[model samples]
Target: MGQLCLVAVMVGALTLALYVDAGRQAEQNAMERMRSLAASLAVNPFVIDAVQSPNPTALLQPYAVDVMDSAHADFVTIMQTDRTRFTHRYPSEIGGTFAGSIDDALAGRTVNQMQDGPLGPTIRGIAPIYSNDGRIVAVVSTGVTVENNNSQLLERLPLIIAIAATLLAGGAIVAVGLRRYLQRVTFGRGPEEIGQMYAFYDAVLHSIDDGMLLLSPGGELVLHNDRAAELLGLTLREGVSAEHSAATGQLPSELVSLLASGKTVENEVVLVGDRVLLVSQRAARTGGKAGSSLGTLVILRDRTDLRKLSSELDTVHTMADALRSQTHEHANRLHTMVTLVELGKGDEAVRFATDDLAQGQRLTDRVMESVDEPVLSALLVGKTAQADERGIELSIVTEGRIPSGLIDVHDAVTILGNLIDNALDAVAEQASPDDRWVEIELIASATELVLTVIDGGPGLRGVSPDDILRRGYTSKPGNGFGRGVGLALVTQAVRRSRGTLSVQDRATASEGARFTVVLPITSDANLNGNTAPVTPTPDRKAPQ
Candidate 1:
């Protein structure tokens, strides 16, 4: 509305100025023509001769009338140097003194002016008529009435008004169209509402823990939250396309693939650099009934910590099962002893109880001797109990001692725990439970911690070891969520510790599969004061 008002005001002001200027121009042209006519009449021999005659009015009256009629002038007059009229269109005024000033003409000069005359306001031109002797004998004056000039201007007024109206109409139309376009772009919301929504969305996008990326349908990176840029190690910019990032190797190829596919991806686990992320994607489309594709929204959740927690949870559940199994077995043995005592066979009960106690004590003592790291020993003991419950024989071989803090307990748990668990699964899958067995070797030295696990079960038939270490690669069917991540988690931990993992198939199916992991343990002195020795008590509650 303000724009419209401004345009209207400008048009009106411009038109008014033009109108006044045009009127002035028209008046100037009319005065010029009248001056020319008066000069011509003043030079006429008939008018000059009559001006010198004794009775000038009678002879000059008809001639003046004819000149006025031919020139379409309002009036023409012939006057003497004394300012007395010689000829006038009004016959009664002939020989009367002229009412208007003609001093310049009387003094042998021509002049023009807008002044009051017999015809009221008029543009009058007066000129001197000279005798044959070059004496000023009379003056000729001609005029165009102001009323006629106004009427002429009015004739052209409609055109000027039409032009101004056209321009104003065009401006109004354009302004209205622009307003509508802005309204649509803003979703019919006012400036305040749009600003508030923008602020709110900005806050939500940055405040969330998960990473988010919005892309156009053509795979251009439209928006990315701070977390997404940090997580993916991306330096985002406006209008940077996904293909460009991929070509430059700035963005992961897997994410680029999802964006280009334009298909919804749900909770797909992908390894991005050293971090594991669970990525989900959805198509963002217009909200209309016939929805058009706008782009894709990619959501990334950093599952690195989550995956670690899950692995620790798995170890906890395994220990819990092992403890429960041991408790059940101990309870059975205790019941037997109690029954023996009730039957009055106290001597037999004592022998049986001692034998059971000695066997358990020997296994613990052997594990404690083999590994000095309390966490690894405790993990092995729990595994031993778990293996016993499943009727699988478990053996541990330790060739070297692990220095205090050489290997982080959590990393050890992740590496050894996963390998041992995979071995146990392989052994338990065998048809003959009697022949099922898992063997583990922990060899720690000043340089590295080498762990090897061999399972007596069906070998990894024709499967690549590298393929097994890949995320989401699993051989067991119906193992569910926690099945495939164990080996991948172990691989991640191993790589972080600057370690290497290898797989070896046994010579025969009866021998089973062997897996080895060698993790380099940097010395505390070489760590630049960044690490200290971890010496926690040997307990099941220790973190893996």
Candidate 2:
């Protein structure tokens, strides 16, 4: 019953995810089409290049609306900036005010809508068209009603229900499906015979997560489940390939090498800004029977955050140890130095350990200054001390003032904090007394914040950039200890800040690698840049 319940929950979740994915895909397609249409209308020769053109129809005359013209086909419309319909699907109403948010878009924003139109509630897209002077002139409105989507769902519903009822095989498990032959074979039989000999197989060449795809034995993509299109970051169009994505960010060379070898392989990969996918393959079965394999199965999970949190936990553990050591050594070292001064061997003892201890103390002191926030400064200060404790030289050089209002404080801390921590790990991975070091640089400008972490270890090698940013790809050799999640989180946060992260082999370094993150600085000139101060509302407020 527990297994059955788990299956049911998975099935239901799969259904919900599919439903949401379909809606999102449809909306995205509609918006892209709207943006393209708006761009086209803005660049129309009749509107821009012609003199004394027909006031309304001339701009729209050369291009017809992109939809089936049947009575049941979903339709779109357009309007002028002043709430006046310029041209729409019902050509007679070219000057009539359209019943939608076309007017809203004319005020200079894209309008994505599900609203009641004269033609019924439609999932409409309205975008502003700009003139030569960059003024909002006309709005392009496009839509397909939910009824159209419902029609698509109805067409797929029967297939979904049939598969659900069949309890089709998923993962490595074989399951029951409809066949009179199976019933006859199972009749009057023992458990083993009934299970193995009597079982009839149903092979579903689709995955239940993100996207699914099946490749034929000839190494061609035979079928693409919906999520596969998304995971590959492709529209449901032809010619999406594994090679295309590998060109953009990076994928494990091992996985790609395996694919190139044309042999069955299952491997996990992280698609930057997408998610982790578990891709596997086996021989495709035939004739609804066992012992046949023909194709590969690809599945995806949005483990983008889970993998991130896991690594953050690890850095936390490392940090905890660093702090523990710092605490243990601070007063004890002070007392020991005092005792050494009282002894006759004071000068010799001071010469031996004072220089390194002073280096550690200097690192700690430098880390604590010029920070507005305590938590961040404290964490970094402790990390700095711990780094010194491990014999790694730490340095922070700033070119100019660290911009105060450039980034959200929390975001700044997380991005820089995690990166520094990761640098410490990379350096400590292969740290030796002679070659123990890391450098952190804060090069800030009015428009950009450049954070670079250079370390001395094995440096960046043996992995693609994607593998470096992937969550679970860890260098620490252990079953349950360290996993590489910090880089993934940093990548995500950097993306959110509209920044870029670059990793390069530190050619000058004797040991480790260097990573640079450039983050955009949001200058305070724009009125929207100023956020309201955090003030508690009257009744909701604790005090004045």
Candidate 3:
């Protein structure tokens, strides 16, 4: 609307200017024409001779009338030097005094002016007529009437209207086009609404804990919040147009490539150094789905802490499962003893109880003697029970005693528990009971710790080891929410401890997978300043 109004005003102003110029030009043309006609008549020999005659009015009147008719002038007058008319349109006034000033004509000069006469307002030109001896004898005046000039001006009305219409049409077209463009880009929002939305956007961008980045379609850094800068370790300034690659060149190559590709991504877990970030990328557009593209929006959520907590929760759940199995087994044994006592077989009952106790104690002793860390020990016990319940043989082998505080308990549990769980899931799919077996080897040295898990199931033949370790690479079928993050978390923990991981086909089995992880066990492994030894007691509460 504003644009239209402005265009309208401009068109009107231009039309008015043209109209004023036309009027001025018309008046100028009329004045020039009248002056030339009067000057020519003043020098006519017939008029000069007649003015010198004893009776000038009779001689000049008819000739003056003929000249007026031929020249198409409104009125032509011939008067003496004393300003007495000799010839006029009104014969009765021919001898009368002229009604307008003739002082310039007496001074032997020509004159042109607008004056009111018997014919009303007119543009008249007066000139002095000279005798043969150069003496001023009479004066001649000719004029174009104001009404006739106005009629001539009215003749150009159609042209003025045409020009004005063209201007109006062009202005309206441009104004409407501009308005439509603004409507699309601004989503039909007014200036006030756009301002309000910008304010809200600014507040939300800085206030959110997650990192947000807006990139241009040409891979330029359009905007990013403080959190995004902090997460990506960027030093950015407002209004600087930095190329996307140069701005984020210090980041992981995979992440930078993903951003540069401008593809739509959702909930992609990317590891940046030791940080586990959940990233999502989406296209930013001006309108709906069919609208023009603005750029891409990349949102980053730090999941490092969440992943750690989740791994710890898995460990706790494993312990709970182990305790439940222990409780159930103890109850069954007690029931058996009660039955024996009721049936008067006390000696047999004692022998049966001693055998069960020895079996449980021996397994516990073996686990404690190998790995003295409470969390790993407890995790192994839970996983063993879980495997036994599924009719799979689980074995734990250790090269040396792995004492407590060699590494973080949480990290150890995350690495060992996720590995064991994956192994169990693998061997559980075997059709033959004898083929379903998993072996864990723990080797602890002065400088490093190595953990290996082997499962008798389908080996990773078609997939690369690096590919399987990436987040969201899972072959097992489930709800798929958390199926693929285990190995990724293991890899993250291993990298945080400056470790290396390897996956291959099991050497002892024809069809099985083996995963081995080596982590530094020295003080250099404490990369996050968490060198303090983890307490031996495990947190038993379930994660909420």
Give all TM-scores, in the order shown: 0.63, 0.46, 0.63
Tens-place lDDT per residue, model 1, 1-544, is 9879988998999899989988998899889999999999999988888888888877988887888888888889888877888777678887688878888887777889889877789998999888899888778899889999889899999999999999999989988998899887776888899999999999999999999999987788899899998888878774878989888887888677667877776766566777777778898767663677768889998878875676577668778987998999999999999999999999999999999999999988877765667877778889999999988888777665655577777778888888888888887877776548887777655566678787786777788776676544567785244456677777777777888988888744456787878888786524332222333212111011
Candidate 3 regions with alpha-carbon error over 4 angstroms: 4-172, 213-224, 231-251, 256-266, 281-298, 338-348, 506-508, 524-544
lDDT of 2 by residue, 370-390 (tens): 343454455566667677677
Task: Give Cα-based local distance difference scores for all models.
Answer: 0.79, 0.58, 0.80
Evaluate residue 318 in candidate 2 and report its C-alpha lDDT on the 0 to 100 scale. Answer: 50
TM-score, model 1 to reference? 0.63
Full-model lDDT, candidate 1? 0.79
Query: Which portions of model 2 show Cα errors greater than 4 Å?
Result: 1-211, 219-267, 274-290, 307-319, 334-365, 368-376, 403-405, 408-422, 429-432, 461-475, 478-489, 509-511, 523-544
lDDT tens digits by residue: candidate 3, 309-363: 7877898799888888788878988999999999999999999999999987888
